[model samples]
Target: MNLYKEPLSRFLISYNLCSQRSAKNFVKNNEVVVNGNSIKDAAFLVDTENDTVIVGGKILPQVKHKYIMLNKPEGVVCSTVSDSHKTVYDLLKGNFNETELYKLKCVGRLDNNTSGLLLLSTNGTFVNQLTSPENEVEKTYFVKLRDSITDKKSYVLKAEKGIEIPPENKSPAFISKSAFIKWLSDESLEITITEGKFHEIRRIFSALGNYVVKLKRLKMGDFILDETLNEGEFKFL
Candidate 1:
């Protein structure tokens, strides 16, 4: 099988198909066509000649090389653009030229108020490899709690019995074997999750009768937040 490689973000930006932010938004919204089929990820690779590229009713030319990272700060939305609040893109202004920055897309989302390491790239396969459930890449978090954890609670948490079932019920439940928690302080903890679910860490602690006061991701897959990067800063990976 013949394969062609080009960074999806670069392709969209180089063609002047859309702004850097818009191109990413388009891909996430499944507006870009690949081989005549709509594909949602901006990192998707295609055969330049055989694959078709269409954006907002126009065709786009291909280009290459796209990867990025962001030290997300609290209060910023993870989206490409937003009407109500600052988005991750707003922080990148002036850092990259309009042409060079177009098509960059986030690998995963961080809640508006949650902060820390965030990855972006136009390498679809690499993104998938890192986030895939089977890959089970470990994600670490530094969390602060509203209450102190007791030994019993720590035992329970370490036993991985704090997770819930169906994840919506008010009553607490546990996953047979999935997560682990380590206390860093009476009111702080480090959690490692193999599965990424919506508001998972917060929910688990909530079930344990403790509320999460602050949350920050420390690592994802092989990447870690560099000490040199301050909040809202970003780097290429």
Candidate 2:
């Protein structure tokens, strides 16, 4: 029988038991068992088909990874679980009949106040590839403004020069990569960027003397928000 191995830590993360760091710590503490023997090494490998891994007295099996597209609604946090506010996981919990399918995680986050296309998955590698800052995966959003950007020409110029991020409490201010902005209306526009930063679109508009009243993501890489999905709804990719 030809067998393959995935590190114990990686498997635990991909299995959605915990984060990679937490999984490693769990192994180092001698909590994981393989073939009835305790293994304290995170690097211990598992044969996908044959080896039985037991965690908390439950036997686990290898499962095929799944990609899920969710139409995230505003106000829901993009975490697996949260103490307050609804989580994206809450939207999925009752929808899936399969326990394995219910273990999906957000690929990248949608801020609590921002809504629209969101991707979730049971596969950790896929999540890492898309979320890595090095990849520069394109993320596009539709923004509505409280203060209209009346100066279209000035807007283009400032955008081309790159929106300057103000220094946070005396830190040196820096310029961000030029963002692609297209006007959808006098007060609404579509913006695209490869980088994900905290409060990025709002900051960009604020720097330009405009206010972002609402924001919704429309696309990321090859995935688009399914118009048919009501807020907080999802479908498999």
Measured by lDDT, the strongest candidate is: 2
Q: Can you write out model 2's per-residue Cα lDDT over 1-237, one digit (the tens) per residue? A: 111355788877767887876876777764678999998887787764478888878888865566788998999998766788898878887677657645676777888999999998766556776788888888899999997656877786787679888755444566878788898778888888888877778888888777888999999877889999999888888
The TM-scores of all predictions, comma-separated, are 0.67, 0.71
Mark the regions of model 1 whose C-alpha exceeds 4 Å error after superposition: 1-64, 99-102, 152-162, 165-177
Ten-residue stretch with the least lDDT total in model 1 = 1-10
lDDT (10s digit) by residue, model 1, range 148-233: 86674664554475345335556344453467777787888788887777677777777667788999999987788886898988
Q: How displaced is residue 202 in candidate 2, in Å? A: 0.8
**Which residue pairs collide in model 1, if any?**
20-102
Clashes of 1: 1
